[model samples]
Target chain A: MSDTQTTVEPVRMGRKATQPLLIVNDLVKTFGNGVKAVDGVSFTISPGETVGLVGESGCGKSTTAKLLLRTLDPDSGEVKFGGQDLLGMRGRALRRLRSRFQIVPQNPQTSLNPRLPVRSSIEFNLRAHGVPKPERVERIAEVLEQVGLPGAYGDRFPHELSGGQLQRAAIARAISTRPELVICDEAVSALDKSIQAQILNLLAEFQKELGMAYLFISHDLSVVEHISDQVLVMYLGRIVEDGTGSQLWNRPGHPYTEALLSAAPGAERERIVLVGDPPSPANPPSGCTFHTRCPIAIEACSTKRPLLKPTAGGSHAACIRTTDLQQP
Target chain B: MTVEAQAELVIDAAGETSDAVLSVRDLTTTFTAGGQRIEALRGIDLDLYPGRVSVLLGESGSGKSVTARSILRLYGASAIIGGSAVFEGRDLVGLNEKEMQPIRGSGIALVPQDPTGSLDPVRRVGAQIVEVLRLHGVVDSKKEAQARAEELLGLVGLPDPVRAARSFPHEMSGGMKQRVAIAIAICCNPTLLIADEPTTALDVTVQAQILDLFVELTSSIGSAMLMITHDVGVAKDLADHVSVMYAGRIVEQGATSTVLDDPVHPYTKALLAAVPTPDVPRGNLIPIIGQPPVSGMTLPGCSFAPRCPVAQSSCTELVPELVSVELGHSVACPVATEFGAA
Candidate 1:
């Protein structure tokens, strides 16, 4: 299914917008120290659909992003992008596929080059994809305008801009190539609330116009639920729950999801304060990793590992007592 | 005795000295850098009662950190402080370093913003706690200090206190490092605790646990807390009283439910509207246009006038003063005050 074209279009072409843009099956990554960071993770994203990956620190959300981005070589997995095998591609074939996928990292200050102008940074991506120099300048201008940044901002260095402006520049650079999928790995986590809202709105607006699917990864559940069409809860290197935003928000099936919702500030429901820290990834529990801190955990939870089973809430949860724990 | 007697006269002159553990009046902080004077904290008034949590809520560059640092006298020589921080019948602003040494940890403890930055990377976690105990004379013998350190570690909810005590800062997680920081801060059990976004670095679940720990430890010791955060939800969950700051000034201050539920100031209302809650549907999130004014920028009138939605012509002419709408509730917006009066 791999298509290598010498002339790359600025927009996604030929694929039906409703079809799956990216698909992953049984992705697994174990580090040097025997820590299974991303263990048997599998999900799919359609064109223009946002899938939020929410989890605590060291819960493999970031590692999953890295694996999908092909920055880290996974131990075992299959990643298909635009009906092409992303894992098997190498050399120029992989490089050509890269223009169809992009990333906006967490810190724009570090992601953006300090020495170069903002326009040049965006131009670098287009140039790498073999775009002509004249076309690169025009595309940079178009993206900067789309992101609501002033045209003069293109000539300014990153240090001259504020955090919000730098993030805008980062977004401009990411969309300059008109990638079908953009992985925002905690993109808005560093900014203040108001700035965060502005960036979120911008991303949503661009997705509407460009029809780009987003893999929005963040530890902030509220932000995730706000922007995501589907949300996945990860814990101890495994996906514990997967459902629609409203489904996960209203009737969280997994104990870990319930605890996360309860722990969020201003949650109307009674707070369920989980005890102790998450176990080390390298030394994760045998049966169920989250059973140690699950509020309604039983003897079976410690003895038998639970698979992703459909719960009463219409969401898939990896828990033995999801039905019993769901509130009316 | 003379300082106490002088403090009595000052307190009476300040009027209506309630049972506040820390009473701040007209607290202003200025920094001089590159021959430029920048006002970090404009004139402010606050009253923190024992066993209650008062949160200073604002966006970045709104002077929340400056307020906490000014109280602790943590700034360098460039900072020109003008205010009164009265704690335990003594003014802290005028006290010299030698005089402030005993009061810093034993009288009022500080939980800094970053636990990783505050903790000693090279030393064991237990040694750091024990050093604080010894420095403040909390315990006499080294062995006793070590035991107390372990006890404090357990109090902060470290699962294996002995193992955690022996572990280095690098050996622990972000949550564990923060717990160690909290353990050291409460080692002396001061009357006032200043925590600057203590849970901002941790995960949401871990943040919930740490916030609960703060409440439990402070109330048990009857210590008033001044928490600084940019999150309105955090203030809502933890604060008994909340102060909404904008452009180096307190635009509103009231009980948490009162201010957050029925915010009068346009800036406070805008900030709340900007937050992305779980209930708020996608595409409904309101983005406050324009950036917060850079710190130290000289604005003639209301600093937030340019961004405030309800700002009128007069808002740019005169700086709004805090008007008491009701008991323990105040707002600095003229339009909001007028509406309340009507």
Candidate 2:
């Protein structure tokens, strides 16, 4: 990046907490094999807050992450980041906007370039975003320090680092770009328990320091509840429930969310063993996609496409019996 | 039998002398890699009783899987096995391939972590189970083996056993594949069944179902289970006896409720505290301060001393051994042991 190039800033920074950092509405995507991976998913994320998107495998959380990053284009709907129409942006504009949000991938082994030293991966992001050469050097050292890695570790290759260290390096690379939002798709799920806590703490620390929002995605419900302020449960390509972590933990409105809570190992609640395998996303069940496995699902649930509605517990759920289900 | 072994068996008060289906004593395994011997298991001891689930709980490098594999003699030429693993009054440690053949499936069976890796991808799920049944001589004919295969699938809670038996490994979901794996493992009615993180790859709801199946099948068949997992919740859910491993040694072992609720070893306490559970509030997880020692690295003292909160000056010099804290509960921490004694 050269001085005096005078490139336009893609995103205006420093928004109030009331305004959303990322707004996704009715996003839809279907794969080549006709799998409706993401089906009309909609959510909003405020700056400096963490929103957990959780579900079992094949529930479209990864597809949603890809669509939000524009790595995979959604077949329909809008993704507005920092008041700009992200999906409508052209080549240079889209590339310029890329630095505004970044990803901390699940597995750092594949995400980080194995051949290059850790410094180069972080430096690559800076250079691509047009950070000056001198600034790039400083940012690399700074981010590495912020993530609790020693300055000397920048010289080491990916394989030299442990799983936890690689994840920290992944976080350093993501934050080196100074992105307003970081999407952590199963970031800590791959790590061991003791190491997982360290990474989670680092994320919380960085979020407070940088004031960046996070779209934390994981199959582990407890980890999601621990890190996220707001929680969204997805089943068969749809958001079954959305609420604050406390609301969903105490009084889950959707049967899928309730079943998920019960199924968690060591969860003291009565086990609701959902029989049969999850149906293929390509051939999802009609109306309520979870009706096939929901323990409390009524016959009407299969016929009616229940919209996201507010429950008595102040959380929004997409179940007809959301109000009456949580009576004890 | 050795005179010392006979004396120890009679004096052992933790469990009934005749109850154990498998008794592992001072089991150690070492592998020669790059001309360096990696001591994966270091003087481990365990007693697996019939109709009970004993969980070996630890992280990846803690040698939980190695313990299970060593019992079954899964390692080839690279591994140097030490100590004894007695199953049904027979020592399994020194047995050759031919001698161990009959014991492998009929005496003991394993349900590995990944069903996809364990199951034959090309063969139908039923054919695989039938092969195990016929190979073990559990059933007389192919016709009887086929019927037993479908019956075993249904026992593991596969809703449609007939259809599941016809499908290939790729055709079934992770949960269903795991069920098939469980079905094959329990088909022989082995006295000892080892499940290595059986539900780790499946969804939570599916994990619950599989856990339920483990309890039901183990009790009904009157087989002892040695379940290996890193998840504390999984151990809490299924384990009747819990053994916590750290840096290739058993740090704690006791009844599940006693060990999990009143953890004596600092490592066990820290591990249980660190895990994010439904009851623990957000951001309250107290992470263990340091990394676990590199696997196979010889330690002079307790492996956990570097990270132990209540480490004493002597802890750096003294290697802790499992000392009884209560009936059926033992902790390998000198500091904790002293406290319990006091």
Q: Which candidate is the best by DockQ?
A: 1
True contacts kept of 1: 0.74
Please, what are the lDDT tens digits per residue for candidate 1 over residues A13-118? 2346545788887899999999999888888887788889999999999999998888998999799998999999888999999999999999999999999999
Worst 10 residues of 1 chain B by lDDT: B1-10
The positional error of residue B71 in candidate 1, measured at the CA in angstroms, is 0.5
- Candidate chain B TM-scores, in order: 0.94, 0.94
TM-score of chain A for each candidate?
A: 0.94, 0.94
Per-chain TM-score of chain A in candidate 2 equals 0.94
RMSD values for the candidates in order, in angstroms, are 4.8, 5.4
DockQ of the two-chain complex in candidate 1: 0.67
Q: What's model 1's interface RMSD, roughly to a tenth of an angstrom?
A: 1.2
TM-score for model 2?
0.95
Clashing pairs in 1: none
**Candidate 2 CAPRI assessment class:** medium
Segments of candidate 1 deviating more than 4 angstroms: A1-17, B1-18
